[model samples]
Target chain A: MRSSYDVIIVGAGPGGSITAKTCAQAGLEVLLIEKRQEIGDPVRCAEGVGKEGLIHHIEPDSRWIAAELKGSMIFAPDGTEIKMSEEASSQKAGFNLERKIFDRVLAQQAAMAGADVMVKTRATGLLRSNGSISGIKVMYMGEVTEIKASIVIGADGVESKVGRWGGIDTSLKPVDINTCTQFLVSNIDAGEYNKFYIGEKYAPGGYLWLFPKGEHTANLGLGILGSKCGTVRPISLLHKFMETYMPQGKIIEMVVGGVPVSGPIKQTVANGLILVGDAARQSDPLTGGGIINAMDAGKIAGEVCIKAKEKGDYSVKILKEYEDRWRATIGKELSKSLMIKNLLIKVSDEQLNQLAHSLSGIDTSKMALPKVLPILFKKNPKILWELRTLFI
Target chain B: MSVIVNRYKCGYCGACVGVCPAGALELVETWIEVDNTCTSCGVCAKICPVGALVVIK
Candidate 1:
């Protein structure tokens, strides 16, 4: 690796790879680093992405897709199911992907775009120049190497410290943190629509989910609020779902991870430093969906960073454009999702049961949240009044 | 006391390491290391995504 570059992105996930690809394609020297020996091994995500947000950026690749989905089923604690209408769910078509393969392909694209790529290179800390980031200190091939850059993109995952190291307060409230565990089980019944289960019994302060990867395979997972999940382990909750829902399922693989269901932080850019993906908490606060948003931020940041490089200014003033562009892009929806997540977790299971009952009688698959939420809680005026921010 | 890691279950995503108040848990890309500073507060165990870290209180 060269001693320095124009951009060095930590973590070769979709966000990092895309940033590297976009900037390198613009003729900037870029380097992408992955801590794992393989680019996308030990996949920790549910691997679901919407086609509307994804297809425009990445072409349809059969090698990375496991299943295409039309809609989803929302189940309440009482086993009542609300099948989203095909049209509504079709508005945002979904896909269950092989993230391990998908991530590697994105990284390879970055390399093809002229970015240097390295696996098993761990970023240990930031290199500070006058209280701002000048480069990164990474353990590459078991040797500490200081690589300098005009810009650094922290595409690290949810537990990323690069934001913290860059003077951004990345602290999360317990309610904002979700402890997630999943099992990829095979030889079970899989369906076209994804399924979601909500209740304290399933996942306190969160929900349980099943996204089908194939005809007889699915990724079953649950996330619970860190504060609400006192003494309750996510694995036990996942196993309970296995026993109660799919007793015949055979375990194929296991993944454990955290999702920052919180909204984006106060700021994502500092002097010569920008945060992307989970590092920036760009994931949807309600569904923990992030791949598209992360890539969105990466694409925007690449453009803004290139502008800054061309002008020979890497200060916070120049970098703030990334934050502005991202906010104008997907930031509003993410903030709304945070509000929705907070309200859902605060409500009781009985209310959720009532919601399921109400929805079961109507066709809500095509309706958006503003149109659907009021009906879901029509009986509870107090709750609706409290959530007026979303509707009104 | 420090937290114990279950090799069979840990995904090594480092959620426990990030939440450690004592700064005792470290994820070195391959293995998790617990230092002598651990007070066994069990925050790491509670915050562990996979239930791999355990505090034997």
Candidate 2:
């Protein structure tokens, strides 16, 4: 392996791969590493991505698309369902992806763009020189080797060591993390629309999702506040949910993971090292999804890395530009989403049922979730009074 | 890279070894260890049946 490169990315997930691909395309030396034997395996997500969000970063490929969605169904605790049409769902109604294929495609794009990819390699530590990141220490095939790089990008997911090693505070409070469990089940019948179930009984402080992958298969999952559900395994909760909702379905693949429901980290870059994806807590605070945000952050980080390379400056001060740029792009939406998440958590089951009823037949085209709050409140001013606290 | 496996939470199902890209994970006396070349990708931590593995920097 070469001892040095212009850029070294720690993970080959969406964020890292996109950064590497972008930099490589700009004629910079880049190395992308994946700790897994396969570029995409042991899928950790619900495999859902927004159509518009996916299109914003890279062109969609048929190989990765499992199903295209038209809309979503929102269910209250009492099972009252509110269906939102595609025209009204905005980009929030995205597609259910085949993550294995989707992740591999991103990594392949990076490799094709001249980035060196090393699978089964782990970045163990940061190589530092006088308090600045100079390179990385990697363990590959039982041999510890040091690789030098001008810039290092950490796309290593929520529990990102790269960020910690680089002296960036990536710690997430228990309240900020959502424990998620999902299963790919067969023999289920659900509409083309993705379904969301909300209530403390279903998933306290979070929600359950039923994403149809095909006519007979779907990814069924739920996320709950990590701190509130002490010692209750997310997988067991998932089985309970499945038994209650689709008792006859057989689970084919089980996936357990955590989603960083926190907003973006205060700092994403520092002196030759930058963080992206879950590592940077770029996932949606309300929905606990990261594919879109990760890719978006990756693109911005990649662009910034190229500029820094050209200017021969890899200082933290120089990289702050990347953080500022992304904040301008998606930061506002993330903050708004976080507020919604908090409000959703505080609502009672009865309130949710009422809210569903109010929104049932309403046309949502050109309207966002927040915009619908007032209309629901008008139906019962008491509920509106209780929810008013959220806006403040 | 070293991986600390919490025996209390580890089911030893070997999912970590199955998904490890570096082939640096294995069941040793009912425990998983970071082989000499372990990359610390935390894939093992991510795939562990019981969330037993925690990667420390």
Which of the numbered candidates is closest to the native, going by highest DockQ? Answer: 1
lDDT of 2 by residue, A1-392 (tens): 57899999988888898899999999999999987778767777888776778887777777788888777777899998776544453444678888898889889989999999999888888998866799999888878899999999999886577887788776665567777778888998866888888898788888889999977899998877765554555567778887876899998987666777777668888899999888888888888888888888899999999999989999987899889988887787788778777777888998888877877677754454566667776776776675565455
Give the winner by lDDT: 1
- Tell me the spans in candidate 2 whose CA falls farther than 4 Å from its real position: A85-93, A365-371, A377-392, B1-57
- DockQ value for model 1: 0.48
Per-residue lDDT for B55 in model 2? 77
The RMSD (Cα, Å) of candidate 2 is: 5.7
lDDT for each residue of candidate 1 in A113-225, tens digit (9 for 90 to 100): 99999888888888988767999999977799899998999998776778877888765556667888999999998888788898886999888999999889999999888
Model 1 CA deviation exceeding 4 Å by range: A85-92, A368-371, A377-380, B21-25, B35-41, B55-57
Tell me how candidate 2 scores on lDDT. 0.78
Write down the C-alpha DockQ for each prediction: 0.48, 0.09
Model 1: per-residue Cα lDDT at residue A361: 60
**Model 2, native contacts kept:** 0.01
Q: What value does the lDDT take at residue A56 in candidate 2?
A: 79
